[model samples]
Target chain A: MSNEHTAGPHSVGRRLIDLVPHIVLIVGVLIFAFPIYVTLIGSTWDAATIGRGSLPMTPGGEAWTNYSQAWSESHGERASYTPVRLMLMNSLIMALSIAVGKIAISILSAYAVAFFRFPLRMVFFWMIFITLMLPVEVRIIPTYKVVADLGMIDSYAGLAIPLIASATATLLFRQFFLTIPDELVEAAKIDGAGPLRFFFDILLPLSKTNIAALFVILFIYGWNQYLWPLLVTNSADMETIVIGITKMIGTGEAANDWNLIMATTVMAMLPPVAVVVFMQRWFIKGLVDSEK
Target chain B: MQRRVIFDNKLLPYLLLAPQVAVTLIFFIWPASQAVWQSVHIQDAFGLRSEFVWFENFTAILSDPNYVGTLRITAVFSLSVAVLSMAVALLLAALADAKIKGAAVYKTLLIWPYALAPAVAAVLWMFIFNPEIGSLGRLLNAMGYNWDYRLNGDQALTMVILAASWKQVSYNFIFFLAGLQAIPRSVLEAANIDGAGPVRRFWTITFPLLSPTTFFLLVVDMVYAFCETFGTIHALTHGGPGKATETLIFRVYQDGVVNNDLGASSAQSVLLMVILIVLTTIQFRFVERKVHYS
Candidate 1:
């Protein structure tokens, strides 16, 4: 860690070298932040201002007007008109249900895989593991057929349930459960604690952090779901914010209301971005842990 | 990896496993098997009847020039997005890994883009590059450059690629930054004391040490480019001025959902599944091989 040799003659050069990293990082931050910044700024301006091709570098006085228009008004000339308010609620329901449902099922399944010695245990584990290879995009049509067959279309069940079965969350929970000391289980056995009691009393309490981390990750994953919701939910009321935003701009680009569209885009991004930014530590942990 | 002391209750274990098993079967296994079944059987145009035609659907899709073109387009698009995003991310990560002031602030700003949905990312860039109203698009036009993606095939592909890469850079950065920080400071310091310049040290020492992370990210980034960019393409170009931007995955959607060609779409889905499984297997094998190396 010593930099003693740079004290005398080369201090200027060392200072410049130090500045280089900062320069690069600052540029990087700006490059990544530029489009988001532009959108935020554009969302504040009037439709005419944006339509005239004048990019606002600063916030305009029409911020509320733009946001309220996006939120409350029926958007587009399309027949399937749903307010952004309905979409946000639908998105919330979908994201929350998927996150909660995934954690519930995944934790139980992980408990079985980690703590139990049932027959065909390896087979069950591999069955769940194989789901990781087949994303929603691959078998989307047939999956749509399955959901349709169950008459789940246009409901929260259709929007959330199919997505709730996550291989990553189960794997994460399994890894976490495996790290629990054997003494805990032994102690529970000695106390005549049943499996459910031990799980609820001890295991759940110990997994608070893991649960939070997975919640943040899965909430965002569910929120950002576009194709599946777009496929499954045809009714306007069932539209998610992300899907709704795309629908808003799904028409000819020349006729799009850039201001309202940008405003909706901003709204669509807020929850997920907030989850990631506010819960940065857990989000990072969840990402790294899930990938591992 | 099972525990020595385990729960022996027969009914309880099955009860614990039931929900996930049911879901995996109904949603995943069932759908995947249907895709395979449909791939071998083509329904008539009117949807009145269907007959088994083993390998006919696959052979038809394999021989179709448009399908072949889509495969090429996917290769180009995936490779471009991966390389562009990975290069930008590696550069940023290397710089940010230095012990610099406000590094945390910079990192926070950079990583939030990862949270943006692909559709949102596409719209944000689409607005910036919209020919009529986009600031950058207008500026480019004013500069006398013909930069309309709406009419031009190559321009649309380039726009989608940029949007996709922009969204991916943040994710790659997080992993690369973590990898860079995990390298031993002593090894780097030793190189410094030996009169090696930063660039030389980076090439000779830092990069090689970071290969595992780099390799891991390569597979993840490629997979991301392959499947997840659907929103990006769907929102922005919708596969285009003339199908120039339609990836294999997009064709699967277009053919199935839009065109209602169930047989061809199922065949495409099966092909995509094979590609992903092969990619995943390679990734796992590489990971296993790396473990033995260290």
Candidate 2:
């Protein structure tokens, strides 16, 4: 432990030595960025050209053709039902519903855990935590069976209802609520504010950073949902964007055109990436907080 | 406080918890239990009906060569992805902590890959590995190595691992970076004063301190790599070229969904759940002790 406290350094040499690792990390970043670049570049090339891997640095003049072809086949497989548009709409609805329901419910649950003295508080918290350990894949089939039995398969509710309680979200809000200054809640109570009023006006407003982070994280989690949606939706009508992309790639039945797949992949990747890029620190912070 | 007593009573708590509890129990717990019940029995090849063959499905799965291979591949895949992703993430996180100019931009670029859904990421990677038109294959062909991803099981597995690792690295990096930032500057300066080299500082000081974060990420990423690589398996390889990429989750999917052998699928799922629980419990037991919050 004492050895870890070294502060002596030759400034320039130290900086230069440190620069070596940073430079290497930049190379790592490039490796990380390669797929994004390849997908974007592939999207611009025609299926024929991109398939041949003959794309030039600049466009060889086939962007419009591929884009239009992609759009046409993609507009709808059935009656104005392109995988792209339909799945995009599905994604928005599913993601929003999950986010809204999850955040709202988790907030309430977290409040109970944080503020109220319920019987077996630790046990309840641990129960929620243990549920987080339950793998989604393990239950996906039985869940499918349940949904099928209920006649909810291929419906929006099928996708949204099953995942209504996000254990991770509840955990996050619970963690956040734990940190709120107790004095404020007391002050609200003294001012004759009801618990609900204090929760809304006093507690929530003070937890903006946490709520913002939670919103972004939950939204991304919802938007990126694939397995449940894939298992739930069969008709082209019910597919989410990610699931649509999955089906559009046409698993063993039809051979896929790599260029078109890449193009669609690029289009599908942008929205979540946009969200992540904007709120990166908060997202990372959220992960760190949860890790604790 | 008396006004709060009514609000805080049993009724309100249950109401607040009702929606989530009901959904989880119905969708997750019920289905999982159903699968467990089904697995003990046997089903027809086409899953039309089940014969009550006690422990037969479990016996068959245990004895099956394919099941063993799936478990091995899954273990290797999950371990490699978790360890490699954590290493890469920590390295990048350390660099970003060096306070280089444009550190924010660098961090943004590094973590962007994680935001892509697994299906999309797998697809994007497939383009790079595509023998016909993928950029990597093209670049490699231009450079003169054969580099066929679909040509062999090893190559195919490698491609999936890389893709999985790529998605995970950003997620690991986010935690690693945050952990790094949380380490106070004063301590790091003190380490420098004691003339510790960077590597020494990292291993002896920084890493031990990041143990809690590392432990947490270890469990999270392991669970993710084990259970959630199904989409990656589906879109990219489809467990093809003789089922090299058939992870436990994907295998369970094939048995339960496409094959519709509800009994056999359920058995596989139960086994998978058992494996997850055991591994997770062991991990928490071993790692939790070493994790120092302060």
Candidate 3:
């Protein structure tokens, strides 16, 4: 360990010192994952077992029964809306639309801001970026009025339109675009390529990484949104998964069903957790790039 | 041709700004103006034919006794959540930055809560806090501790704060990690060469370098604490255990969503917005200048 004291980036034994923190990190991950692990385990249990918090990893009864109960409550003693299919579809619709639409607009807008020598270029750029300050919380009431007035509430358009144009996306693209050499644009100009042509031809190919990164972030955000959807959608048909899960546990007095509620909550969480694990590389890269 | 040329450049600028301006006007500008308009005029939001009764609602809000308590509770809740979340986030960021092996796994797992729709986080916390079968309850019971958030005001405040801070830590951690990594690696290596001990290096070099990130985080965290905690508040406590966990945004939600008192809610909303704007301006103007980018 002392052999490379004066050397540059030394040996194998020294690397273990760097790894000391990682051992702690593994424990930290377990602590963080405890709630999620509990959610999954609890969901698998029947009502009687879940309340005890003594449910084993594998339940005695059918595993698919909880899944079915969480998905369709009518099959059980109660014949009513459990918010299974309707909310799932609504959330997916809202999230997918936001992802595709925001990314679509971001690509064009970011591409325009990056490749062109347009007038008010910097001013226009900042104008879009400043929307970051307009927290949705601040604007929720008024935005609701606008959505209502537009006759868009409870519809897919209301859920998606206001969020499609993202300041963060534009800023990220502008930052990435800064790294591209101007010589390429100049050469494209000499090759009789218009600004549009230059963007589609020269710039688009170079931005695959950025596009991938942006989609993952925007997708997660769109998927996880709760408040705006809850506010806009009044119809049981239009409720999101999160809202459905909340409604399932309505008021403490009505004999709150722990089994169905936990089961549904787990179902609501699966896709986003999968997104976090799978898209993490792109997620971290996207964040790091924006910081730069 | 010359006459057409005059307006062309000017028109292009507006054309570029048109979509953004349109959406802003539709969503933000109009809503803000409506918020202000509703503040002064007294009217039923859900009912027909709202009449303009100037200053009526504002006076009603100020005089309301419960509102006074609500405001005090809100100020305390939001401020505490901000400070506590920032502190916890800074610690997590430091731990994550220690270049630990599975820190990425920790980072991802910790941040998963942030992605759980605030609504779901609220529901999840409520289940965990359930006295009979909640994990926290069972754990506390096992330890011979009687932790009842429903009957205890102080405990309710503590419980809500813990939940809010838990959700918020990841929000701040991401920013802090970015800020910590932004501190040039070469400079830190230089400090190491000078024989700076771990504690000394952290206090003298790392903390100072991370200040900009910390400051940026403070502002962002404060805003999140103020505005974004509403869904959690609504789901978990509903300003319960005798108004112990009520916050500004929670109060607004109570007024608008529950009481359906549009007028009072609008006034509270306006006041909240004013405080945030003033804080944001000070943050950008004064606090931002003190940060050393290098």
Candidate 4:
């Protein structure tokens, strides 16, 4: 189909009709961008300016002071005073551990289920698959009990380990591995290559795209985790940036440092948003494909 | 769909599956079973006594007015979020799907909000609507409207819903856009050639074709609203202004963690599991049918 067929002979009225999509889309984009824009501008201003309502639309001159204060020390008179730097580091560790751990174990299990015929193979697969119904929130209490029993509470393992038993990633990898041709396995067999070798040499290389895609999704999932970290992490040192920012707000009091909190919010959102924006294609692929 | 030629390994497969299976069994299976067990068994307030109470906890939860209120709130909240987000997303997606300049830029700009945490999104909105320091809130007050979410239950519910829906629009937009793109252009072109206007063609040809994606998103969005909006509610209103915004999930947290009411919380959790299982089964069945059709 040529563009002219859709475009038609453009009368003035027809041209105005054609502009509707752009107009609506621009409005939608502005609505979506406005919050972040406000946050960005708010981060640059001091608390006193923000507190005296009618927030300034323009960036202020306190960007350096606000960011430095937020990054290093706790400014608000909150109970817990963990620095944003420590919280960001904690979030990074948790996110990385979850993404890497989920991928590693899921791929292994997927490889095993795809390549080898063993006793109770379907049983094992179903065991993992059944977990799709059990989110951390549903079984929060019992899971916390189990973690406490294992003495993993307030630890990094507690933060990430309970989250890594992912049915979706395993299912995603398993689905991908099933599409690999049997001829490759046969060729490897004829060459006296063992299962592990074939996996290392063939399967791992083939799964690179899926791995990277899943990593982006899982990393964001890990970073954005709120309830689990809020429950498990007792010490301020173990706080993720997401929970940390909320703590800094401290009941929405006027005494709260709005500028510093906004700065921390920016820092908190930077990594995951950057990942999604930079790896847009893979992130979309991973999300859509994994859900399917 | 098992592979034709497979490895004949026995011990290695178990070894390979150990970590995932171990985690699932220890964390997921065991805790889930414990939830079931705890729902049936009641515990005293202190750390000492316990009693086997069959269906008592379940009955208590079902009979509680607050639980029922939470159930209603969850229904309203999830439906509003799903409808609001999906509606906005569909509009934006339809506009972007048109042959327009800078569609890609609009999509990139629109989709980044999906990366923001629900808590962070709540905080952003809180900053915007905080009545004290919030620009919009101040504007609303200046317009002679009482716009304090912190003091009013209805306002609190509205604020949380807006924040939650704002964060979720990007996700639904991506899916809706993908669904729109997957329609064969020839079919649309034929519709255009048949003298059908754009609006008519959209209603007749486009929407029916998009139903599968629409159905899929509805279920996904409902699940997201039910399970994932905890942070938004927590940060924005703390399920407060007198239990107005407390969804089932938030109520579970309150009963479980804060009040130390383990039995009631476990019962609630089991109910949520049933809800999730039903949703998951529906989703999987629809997906399988979709796969067969494709």
Tens-digit lDDT string for candidate 2 (A170-281)? 8777767766666666776678887678778876777677777777777778888878888888787777878777666664222345455555666677778888888877
> What are the per-residue Cα lDDT tens digits for candidate 3 across A1-292?
4645764356676676667556655655565566666667777667677656655655446347777866865233332554576678888888888877776666666655655455666766665655666666765676777898999988989988887767777667766776666676566767777655666787788888888887767777788776688788888888888777766666532245567777788888877767767887787676555443
Report the C-alpha displacement of residue A10, candidate 3, in angstroms: 16
lDDT of 1 by residue, A1-292 (tens): 4556757436887788788888888888888788889999988987678878887799998788878877888553332346788899999999999999999999999999999998899999999989989998999999999999999999999999888788889988998998898998999999999899999999999999999999998898888888899899988888899888877776545556777887888888898999999999999888887887
Rank all candidate structures by their lDDT, best first, as comma-separated numbers. 4, 1, 2, 3
Output the number of the lDDT-best candidate.
4
Ranking by TM-score: 4, 1, 2, 3
**Candidate 4 lDDT tens digits, A1-292:** 4675666656576889888888888888898788899999999998888877757899999999988888898665333367889999999999999999999999999998988888899999999999998899889999999999999988999999999988999999999999988888899999999998999999999999999999999999999999999999999889999998888887888877888888999999999999999999999999999988
lDDT per residue as tens, model 4, B173-204: 99999999999999999998898998899899
Where is model 4 more than 4 Å wrong at Cα? A1-8, A76-80
Clashing pairs in 1: none
Native-referenced DockQ of model 1: 0.81
Which of the numbered candidates is closest to the native, going by highest TM-score?
4
The DockQ value obtained for model 2 is 0.51
- Top-DockQ structure, candidate number: 4
Give the per-residue lDDT digits (tens) of candidate 1, residues B8-91. 888888899999999999999999999999999988878788899999999999999999999999999999998899999999
What count of clashes does model 3 give? 1
DockQ value of candidate 3: 0.35
Badly placed stretches (over 4 Å) of model 2 are A1-19, A68-83, A118-127, A181-183, A251-259, B1-7, B43-54, B141-144, B279-292
| Separate DockQ for every predicted complex | 0.81, 0.51, 0.35, 0.86
